[model samples]
Target: MQIVFLIEQVVNGLVLGGYYLLIALGLSLIFSVGGVVNLAHGAFYALGAYVSVQLGRHVGFGAAAAVSPVLVALIGIAFERFLLRRFYREDPILGLLVTFGLAMVAEQAIRMIWGAAPLPASLPAALRGPVIVGDFLFSRYRLLMLGVVAVVLGGIWLLLNRTSFGRVVRAGIQQPDMVAALGIRLQPYMTACVMLGVGLAALGGALFAPITTVHPAMGAEILTIAFVVVIIGGLGSFWGVVLAALLVGVVRGVSVHFAPAASEASMYVLMFVVLMIRPRGLLGEPIEKFER
Candidate 1:
């Protein structure tokens, strides 16, 4: 019985971790490539969820799921080209402030469009039921989410480690000026990074829409936790983000299962402990003068 309970908790942890990974991966990429904190990332996430729900209601679940991320990515590209690009050569703090303002604007815009109420978002019929594994039963949608996240992480890993674009990104992160001096246009790469980040955030929002309430303020609520994952995982390390997200998820999941009253506070506590021990984060590189 104890073993079964443990397995169940582990499954729950993975589901939560999958969502966290999706959000944190994008944040990590943006930070590493663009040096932007992107406070409005969660807003993009909420936008994706709202759009997905609306589309799902009109067209169909499959079609909505397929198109929502593309639309969100286009929005991200617009933000990158118009707003984010201007701040690339300026102070990082400026980008932070701009994104924070954008986040507020996005939240209000969502309110005006969707109202403050939570909307209904249902999973596809194919993923509506639970699957039994040994003595425990797990939600099919949760497992599907896990599989999607795994595939995404693997794809990202391949993109970063096995592709020429990855080399360019790494070089830029390490030496932006040198790359620029070599005649490389850093603007396009940065724009791509923003799109990638926002797309991942959108994906997370869409995936979680069926499980959680879809409200305009939902982004603000989850942004803090996503930031925590970024901090704990180390700002620019993709693998670190994944590991930290999983750790945070497990911590929160176990807390929810064993101490429901304290579940909400556990992630914060974990973040505090991590920061106290490793101020630079688990896999974060030290910021050099060039990076600044």
Candidate 2:
């Protein structure tokens, strides 16, 4: 029985890790391309949940989930064009400070518009309750979420590995000046990257809104863990982020079963240990612009 319970927790943690990947991958991508750490990234995530919930009141949950990220991606266009574009290739601290302030403003806006209370998001009755397979049990909704993440992951992998756009982005990460020398403008790519980053974050928020409490500070909460995943996975490695997110999830889940009190702290501990072992992070590679 104890082993069975442990297995269930592992599975649950994997699902949670999938959620973490959606945010961390975007953060990594934006930073890799633009050399800016987006503190406001979580703000987009909060917006996704709020927008989806509001949209859900009108359209169904499925439609709300689909539309919410698109709306947030539109906002990301402005964010990159007006704010982030200026910070690119500038001092890293300046980018951090500006994004941090943006995060504060976004949270306040949410408070003003949505109030401080948590909003309840529900799935359709057909999607609710437990799913059983053999002796293990799972949330029906979470299984669906897992499938969604898998599809997104595959789509992103294909985008980055098999496309011309991805080739330029990759070269830009390693040699922005060289890409410019080749007469390839990167502004469009950076904008698209930011849009995709925030869009992914929003998608995560929208998907998880039903299961998690939606509040103004929720962005901050997830941001901390997302950063943890990024740090553990390395600065710019896709597979690294994926590996780290799953590891963090599994660590936290195992902690819940064996040491419930330490569940929340487990990922941090894992981060600490991994950093000690590999300072650049597991699978983290060197990028030129970030070297200085």
Candidate 3:
């Protein structure tokens, strides 16, 4: 019985971590290559959930999922062009303040449009039951969510590691001046990074909406968790985000099972321990920007 329970918990942790991975990775992408402190990333997340839920009623969940992220991504790209681009060479605090203000505006707009009530989002009927593996069972929706996250993450890995553009992104991150001097336009790539990050944030929010409430404040709540994961995993490390998310998810799951009251606190403890051991994070390179 004990072993079965533990196995079940492990699966649950993986699924939960998938949700965290989506959010944290997006934030990392923006922070790393976009050179913007995007505090409003969470707002784009809320926008995705709300847009998907509202649009899903008419067009179906699958279509909504496909559409919401693109729309949110466009919004992010626009914001980058209109507002964030100005601060690229300025102090990081300037970007932070602008994005923070944007966050506030987004929340207020959401509250006004959606009202203060928590809207409910339902899982598709096809995903209502559990999938049994041996003697253990996992929620079908959660399993599906996990699969979706895995595919998305894999695609992201390919995008960053396989393509010609990926090489440009990698080189650009390390040597922006050199890339520009080589006649490769970095401005377009920066916009692309912001769009990609915002879109991923939206996708994460939409995927988790059926499991959690579609509320105005949901962005802030999830952002808090995602922020911690990024900090623990390292500011801009891809693999670090993946590993830290899984660790945080597993920690939260085990804590919830063993000590319900300390589920979130467990992640904090883990963060504290990891930071003490390696100040740059598990797989993170020391970021001069962070030190500044």
Best by TM-score: 2
102-182 per-residue lDDT for model 3 (tens digits): 899999899999898988899888979988889988898888788888999999899999998888988877777788999
- TM-score order of candidates, best first? 2, 3, 1
Best by lDDT: 2
RMSD per prediction, one decimal? Answer: 1.5, 0.8, 1.4
lDDT of 2 by residue, 141-245 (tens): 988998999999999899989999999989888999999999999899989989999999999999989889999999998999999999999999999999999
Residue pairs with colliding backbones in model 3 are none
lDDT of 1 by residue, 1-292 (tens): 8767866886688678878888888988888887788999999899989999999998987678668978999999999999988876688899999999999999999999988888888887888999997788888888888888899889888987899888888888878889889999888888888898899999888888888999999898888889999999988888789889998888987887789899889988988998999987888886553244
> What TM-scores do the predictions have?
0.95, 0.98, 0.96
Per-candidate total of colliding backbone pairs = 0, 0, 0
Candidate 3: which stretches are off by over 4 Å? 287-292
Segments of candidate 1 deviating more than 4 angstroms: 289-292
> Over the full model, what C-alpha lDDT does candidate 3 score relative to the true structure?
0.87
Ten consecutive residues with minimal summed lDDT in candidate 3?
Answer: 283-292
TM-score for candidate 3, please give it.
0.96
